[model samples]
Each structure stands twice: as structure tokens, then as C-alpha cells.
Target: MSVLRPHGSAFSGRLGWGRAPAVVVVDLVRAYTDRDGPFGLPDPEPAVAATQLLVDAARADGHPVVWTVVRYAPGLADAGLFVHKVPALACFGEDAPGHWGELTLKPGAGEPVVVKQYASAFFGTTLASTLHGLGVDTLVVAGVSTSGCVRATATDALNYGFRPQVVRQACADRTPALHDSNLADLDAKYADVVDLPEALAHL
Candidate 1:
């Protein structure tokens, strides 16, 4: 009898880039990049730098580039249970001081920005319809908090019938452990966790 290796040993199938691909930058805002902010990651520069490369490549390739930012109504009224669970999310409040919600990696003119209050960019957003209208079948996802928004967006992209390619170098988390673990799980099941060059070539 053959012995099984591990949880992800048999799940190594790859979903190469499809006919139409879009680069999705998820929640790469000052809230997480600003070192002094409540939800800031320790070392977010590398991820930000890597994501910028993906954005540039997508723009040069004439592919769609979608951006997501976390925003909530005044007094956290629109945050629902999410704010309750993570009180630090108040950094995204409309009145949050100093524009904590601003995107660190600026989007190009006319790029679509999706405002989301949840981890998954598709939740309560028009991202799916927009992608459909643009004829985008594959999504190259890059952004902050690999264990949170990035993972959520990539998984939802796959659930919504879009091939999801998560760029490993373009994602950050509170710690390297969290970042690596989530990427492993995502690559094993939800999306193809690809390198920056692989994603850029695909774009």
C-alpha cells in the first residue's frame, strides 16, 4: 500500500492564466502600510514594491487593474460585526485622521476602485459584474495582509469562477509565519500562489 504524504501533497494542480487577466490590488492602503497605524504590518515595503511592479506591468500590457480600499461610514455605522471583531478597523472610518485609508500604491487614472468593508473584495461589491463586463476571466491578486484580505480576495475570485493567481512577493502579513502559512494553504486549495515574475509575465 502507498503511504500518503501530507495535506497538500495531492492538491498541486495548477490553473495557468486564462484568456483575459486583471491585476487586483487588495487593501494596500496606509492603514496597513503606515508603520504607526493601528493595523500596520512590520515590514510592508517589499510587498508594496512588488505590487507596484505588478500594477505597472498590467498597465503596460493593457490589462485591467482593479484596486480595493477599506472604508466605513462615520462612527463605524457601516462596519457591522467586522469592526466589533477588530476594533482597529476604525482606521478606515471616514473620519479617520490623516487619510489612513489612502492607497499607498496609487492607481492609474480611470482605474476602478472597489470600496469594501469586509475581507473579501467581492463581498457587497460590484467587482464580479465589473470583471465580467471587462471580459476578465483570470485575476492576478496582490496586496496586504496575506492571511486576511489577500487570501479572502483570491479565494473569492476562484469561487466566482475567475482563475486566481496570488503573487507571493506582493503580499504582506503581521508576521512571516502568518504570511507563509496562508500562502501555503491558498496555493494548496484556493489559488495558485505565484512569484512576482510569473504574475508579471502572465499579465
Candidate 2:
């Protein structure tokens, strides 16, 4: 879609942007971005490419650009039950090969990269504190698997008192139905479901 307009959207109002807005790119790693990888979905290239624009805009706007990745310790000791539900998460193990844990976006020098063991970036990570220090009040979210990590992070961003905005073009899921449905759910209650242009304007 070229705009922020969502068809048949049940949502009423836009939370819009707050005083300080930050961008959070979730799990855009080889395990999710790589087509041949175990956890890989179809092609997320368009989503990844679209996200760079928002990322650059956020950086230029002087807003914090945070990246979240799933990395587990040896023997998957820290993963809890999530690992068992999705055994493919082993691809992000500390002892996993370098290529398996590769990041699609090479974070800039000062960009904060939050390593998470669970779906939400706020879970078992310093994302909240990092955002606190950066004085972030709104979060522009983008990343792989809209129904998974992206959804989890956006939900937590709202629960943590930050206005969350999910860019439709910058987030992907394995199927179109899953992507559209989740975005609808988020727009109805959790966050604002926007397009690339809308996200940029907020930044």
C-alpha cells in the first residue's frame, strides 16, 4: 500500500506521535531473513528494504534506532519453553555458526542492539531503560514475522507506556492473511498500523 489508509479498519483514532519517537527493528537476522535458513519465511526483502528508509529517517531525526535479535546461550539454557515450541530457534545459539546468526542490517556505531531470548524486545533486555535514557515516548516498529516478534514488541511498547506504530510495508509474515489479520488486531487496540510514508512523517 502507498498510504497509511487501512481498508475495513475497525479502529477509531490515531495515537499519532509523541514528543520523542524511536524506531525498533526486530529480528531482522539471517535466521528470519535468509530464505534457506531453518526459521526463514518466504522473501522478506521488500520489507527489509522498506525499513532502511525509516531507519535512516529516524537516525537523521536524532531519534534512537534500536535493533533486536534472538540469541541464546549454549545448550539453550536461557530460552525457556519458547525454544521447545520452535526448535528452529537453535539457529541463534551462541555456539551456532557465524552465518546462522548474521544480522541483515549492520547497525551503526552508536545504535543500540538489544539481544533478546524471547519474542518481545522488552523481555529480558534493556530496551526499556535504553529508551528511557534516550527519552523515547513513541516507537516506530519494523521487522520480520509481523505475527511474532514484531507483534510482541509493539504490544509491550504500548504496555510500557510508549505509543507504538507498526509500518505495514516494513513488517512481514509468512502469509498475507497472517500479516493483514495481525495488523488489524494491532490497529484495533494496540498500535497504529501505518505505511512507510506515515511512519516517516511521525519520525
Which candidate tops TM-score? 1
lDDT of 2 by residue, 54-148 (tens): 99998888888999888889988998999899988888889877567778988988998899999999988899988988899999999978999
Per-prediction TM-score to the true structure, in the order listed:
0.94, 0.92
| TM-score: model 2 vs. ground truth | 0.92
Deviation from native of the Cα of residue 158 in model 1, angstroms:
0.5
Candidate 2 versus truth, CA RMSD in Å, comes to: 6.0
- Model 1, position 65, has a per-residue lDDT of 97
| CA lDDT, candidate 1, residue 45 | 93
* lDDT winner: 1
In candidate 1, stretches whose alpha carbon ends up further than 4 angstroms from where it belongs are 1-9
In order, the Cα lDDT scores of the candidates are 0.92, 0.89
lDDT of 1 by residue, 1-203 (tens): 99967675579788878999999999998888989878878999999999999999889989999999999998999999999999889989998787889999888999999999999999999999999999999999989889999999999999999999999999999999999999999988899999988888877
Clashes of each: 0, 0
